[model samples]
Target: MNIGIIGGGAIGLLCASYLSQHHDITVLTRRKEQAEEIRTSGLKRTVKGETFRASVKARAGITGVFDLLIVTVKYHHLQEVLDGLSTLPRQRILFLQNGMAHLLDLENWDTSHSIYIGVVEHGAMKVSDHAVNHTGIGVIKWGAFHPEDTAAVRNALNETPAQFQMIYTDEWKKVLEEKLLVNVCINPLTALLHVKNGELIANPAYEYMMKCAFEEALSILGLAEKERLWSHVVSICKKTAANQSSMLQDIVKGRETERKAIVGYLLKKAQAQEITAPHLTFFNRSLEVLEKKQTKSFE
Candidate 1:
């Protein structure tokens, strides 16, 4: 299958590096400079201290038809990607964003793409313009927004490399809900506290706050009855104990975080459901303040 991966970020580059071995891949970078660098040096990836470059087509603009279009951009940039692909065929579009916020955008898409959403548990970091480090290996859950997308999703999974495993499921909402629970609880707290993933569970005060924030979010989303949700959050912290949450990495790097898509989306849902989520609301505001500061500094 021919694949066009958008964003060229950590997840994008990681996926391109692995998938390029079996499929023809084209990576779309946000800047001409990065694209040019990839074209000249190829896309590099490091796993377990071993590194190699994969030769793949790299470009700055979206063009031509593809068997699959994997969108690995942040949630805030989803619309820009969609707009750029407006003229192309949307047969098999895969979105690998962080939060459930992009579901609304997908719902409103007036295209013929067999839309699929992937919840990535793998931990990866972009080391440079053309390189990425795969920190932790995890399974990717594939969920289709529509029934017609199952076959495409299965084929994509069938082509998965040995190092990565893909599971196809019909419970997309539950999958996303689980992922959102973790992101809303862990990502913001780590970003705000400027702590590592383990600190959230290891420190008593931070653990208290983590539970408080998570319970409030679960209650608002009516997932309080699901016992597994809390355990899932703790498990993620334990599994990726030494690593920084993506939001914390972004904040530390002075880059924009995905606060709006995760916490901001929950706030809207809480308002619509008439649930008061003070903890989430507080963190959401705090994250916005940090984002604004980062933007001002960049300016």
Candidate 2:
């Protein structure tokens, strides 16, 4: 299987590294330095028992067809990424990003773009130039986001290092709603407060804010009532209370956070429903302030 990974960040690099052992892996990046680093030293991974390296071809651009094109970029860059990939005929485009906001636009992107809405719960981070730390255990949820995925996707997924837990059903709306609940509750507050997943447990301040974001998002999920939505949010937060979310990690790096993708997406959905969620708006606003502060510091 020729697997081409877009976005040389944690997910892109890690997926390419693991899949390379079983398949031909190609990593696409904009940075020449990362390309040189990967070509010289291969991809380095640090996990529980062992740390090893694998040779994955790193490239600065795309020029050929690939069997699997993993769309691993952050949600905010989906448009630009899709535009670049427009020439790559028919391929399996698995979206491993977070949040529900971007889903609305997916149907419009290329009606034939076999979309697989993948929610990766894996905790991975770049420890160095070509090294990544796999911090936690999580599986990839496949066939839930888009039903267009064929048997080939299943075959390719089974071939990869990551286990694919297939939700074989036409009712993927429920799955996306569950994912949206997690993103709204965890991503924003964690980034805003500079806290890890466990911190949301210690601080009632974040918990309260998370509760608000959840209520707003749940309502948007079209689950019927606002209170029912809030209940789902509360239960899930307590479940994954230890890991550091990707959005929070982005904030710590002083880089652009995925607030627009997470919170901003929810707000847009709520607006379409003609509903006002003050809490979602509040978190979105709070993130704006924090983003502005971080941007100024960088400037």
TM-score of each: 0.95, 0.87
Model 2 bad stretches (over 4 Å): 144-149, 162-172, 224-240, 294-299
Candidate 1, residue 216: lDDT = 80
Using alpha carbons, what is the TM-score of model 1? 0.95
Best by TM-score: 1
RMSD of each: 2.2, 3.1
Per-residue CA lDDT of model 2 for 148-205, tens digit only, reads 5377767766765643233334545566667778777888888877777767767887
Lowest lDDT 10-residue stretch of candidate 1: 290-299
lDDT of each: 0.86, 0.74
Model 2: which ten-residue window has the lowest total lDDT?
162-171
Q: For model 1, what is the C-alpha lDDT against the true structure?
A: 0.86
